[model samples]
Target: MDEKRLCLAHDDSLRMLRLARRCDDLVLAPAPARVLRDADGSIDPAALVAALPNELFAPTAQNPVDLRFDDDASRSGCSLVRSCPGLLRLPDDAYLEVLTAEGDPLCVCGSTVAHVLVEAGPLAMTSAAVTLGRAVGAGRLSRDAALVRLTGFAMELCGRYARDPLAPLVGDVVHDIEPVSSVRELRAFLDEPTGLHGVELARMAASYANDGSGSTMETCWYGVFCLPPRLGGAHLTRPLQNVALDWPAEAAGLVSHERMRPDFHWPRYETACEHQGGDHTSEQALEEDSRRARDYELCHIHYLPLTKKDARDVNAVTALLAQLLSIIAPYETDAFARRARRMLNDEGVCAARRVLLAQLLPPRLRWCDGDA
Candidate 1:
């Protein structure tokens, strides 16, 4: 057939037919080469008859010849004269051997796992963590296996060269998955001989990670507070989270519970830091805060309640850190004193702090030359 006639025939076939598969020079069965109903749901016999090839109309009983279209026009060129209904219904990751107009085998809507990971970016860690948690919660995955999987993803993502590595974020994800592993388990993972990227950062993050954190925001607060001051951080000792406290009998009705557990605490100084965000605005929350404050006063422990705004303000955080440091200084151990002395003179810490500062701060707010 002439090229024009072939093109016209293919176009007409595609309009009504769903191409199942095309073998070498043959269009196989199940291609559905007929439309029995019109848009108004009326049977169109003439339309169906017209859609079928001449071979189908003149068919004998036995040996049937498969319908064949011009290979040059349908398979070897950029022609939209073929439709694959199966391909349309499958997912983007599904693999199918489809031929281009040039008759070259091409993948239809398939992509690698690495490509999907790259496309997801930093949220991939959060997503994987959340998914594993849900799976465990639903009893689909065991808690131990889920922790391994979560840590595996953390290893993969954090090892790569990324600004917001998975190390720091994995803790919150693991926390959400409940019955989280001990810090020892995380350390064991870190010690394993795996080809994980960014090992140093991963180790550092694991050192500071704790399942005791109540929320992602609490994790963020912990991270920022541990870094040196030059990096928009407080350089404070890592505080224990959600430490249980005994409340006086008089506070039983005023607070929600007879016992109190502060959000973050320094046991050495008996100082506690409470992070008050929108959840503390209720009347019950106000009463609880008041009762907690009175309880701390009775116990002779310092209480500092901070808001999100306090955490965001660099100067405010610095001042709060100073207060914490002063209170804890008297109780600082010889070992801690030695570490503090070393920190003051450590060039490596200074360099690392500069890199961390760049990562954490916005470009405009970052330290410039001689700005301190």
Candidate 2:
């Protein structure tokens, strides 16, 4: 892999994740020195580490934020793990973790320095895939949180966002280059990844992953509904995410719209799920939502509407799951409902999953405890 790159050592995951939210990749003010390159033109790790800044300016819980996420404890230093000889066994929460490397390693599976940059003015920080791979290999996060991030990263790799590796997490898509990666490509990436740790875990998480998420919460909720019961979910059949559908004549007339795009849809069951965020509270959006519900009634497609409030509540989600199972009639309706309750209640498998995801997820995308 001779691609020009700027890599982050997977350390202090919280700090890295914070920076990643601001700029998915960093565009370094490239400074060229002959020491950075070997005679063969490959990157010289020792030279690169000494040349780069260990830390740069960033937010302490998303800049200019409310009192909730930001605090004094979050003001800790953001260290950039550097590479040199004897680079092995870093703190597990090390920068862009490297569990192992190939025949040509950056270090002994524990240290990583940036690759030989193209020296094209500046260098970008790190790719979402690289962050995800490192996080998984580091083995610091809970499996649920790691898998959620893996899925989100895979989605970022797909569609318009693929073009701008440095695009902000919540920014508009980049239209310059067409998307060329998907969850499948992510799997392929992990298969022969540029030496890192936790290849197997990342691969396994990718196996359960799908793309086409509109937001972090959407991705998290999808995992909630689709992951097997063992993973603290109902294990329902996976559904298509954010797909456009040609509405029937009756449906269009009912909603006064010709096109219908459901956030989550199951073709076999003819059911759909929509996640309502802050934008949905507007007067116009409320009217549209009312019309949409009417349209669903006319079309006979079972619709499930979820909001941030519904997402975080165990009783609410359990009740919602029961209703969904009743329509599908897969298992005894009451059983699945009760199962959801057991899984999501305090100290339940899903409850723990939620707590961790809330902590690990990026800025403005957390399932904060008091927010709901």
Candidate 3:
């Protein structure tokens, strides 16, 4: 990263830190340099902790956000848990504890606010968290707890915002409860046209977007919720159109594109499915499946299949990388300030500097092992 760009990222992290503190939304963790062992009996632990920021090392609540629940949740089959495999891994005790926490219903798994809405019969008080708990705890505890937890959050969000037409839309899709035997099945479910159930749900989402009656959740719904599944799948034509009509020119620009106007070539989910050798899936296989899914998701956004050399492709890759880095970059703090200065003063910090700078570098078009 260029000096200017690095400084900019540094500044952004500092700003984010301040915002996090003010909003009480973030915790800082800092990684200090470690000592090195030389052939000569000289040991410098400090040498190991390079430019790792203090903000990142400090204990914080954000670490759990990095976890991706790709485990099989069949601990015991339950209606909600059976539908989403990602939730299967949570221990029974932990699963129940999270659901029962008292707060405005939110996905504690990550800081993301729920976007999907659902019907929670006649509740005078509607909170996203409460509604989510209700969904997860609806039946016997036997099921994929995580799916019930996450999808419940989605469904709850939909319910709380029932006044907003988009609520029904989110409710229909998220609460449909498909019994996904594997990640492949889940991927297929997401990629396929919304079944009659999904279509009806989408139609509701569109109706809400179209009528423009309850635009309160527009930002959350479009900017964050729809992003993961937006690029492909489902008949989004009408919803996109409705969004285009309702959103300001700036927000509309984010979701709308020329290709969006036309019918898109839908992929067959079978192609994306990984073939695990045996009936009993191993941890290694699950790990492999997770790797494939990550690649597939990133490829959907970053792949330059047809235009390897195109400037647009280059720009997209770079922008995506920069945005990702911004999301993960450690915020500035007393320790970071000291380290930043030291990195400038000492050549040793150059390695740390490079890692941070890579965020600003134009993302390469070729495949990378990970976002790092």
Best by lDDT: 2
Please say which candidate is ahead in lDDT: 1 or 3.
Answer: 1
TM-score of 1: 0.43
Error of 1 at 353 (Å): 7.5
Worst 10 residues of 2 by lDDT: 116-125
- Model 1 weakest 10-residue run by lDDT: 112-121
**Number of the predicted model whose TM-score against the real structure is largest:** 2
Tens digits of per-residue lDDT for model 1, 1-372: 100111112122221111212123322121112111101111122332233345323322242212223232233121222311211121121111123345432221222110000111122233344456667779986544444334333333322111222233322122222222345554665455543333333444455445466544454455456644333344677677775876556654555456677778877678888777458888998887887788787766789887755544344444555565556667877765655546544565444434443333333332353311
- The true-versus-predicted C-alpha distance at residue 128 of model 1, in Å, is 11
lDDT of 1: 0.41
Give the range where candidate 3 is weakest over 10 consecutive residues by summed lDDT: 1-10
Backbone clashes counted, model 1: 5
Taken over the whole model, the C-alpha lDDT of each candidate is 0.41, 0.48, 0.24
What is the Cα-based TM-score of model 2? Answer: 0.57
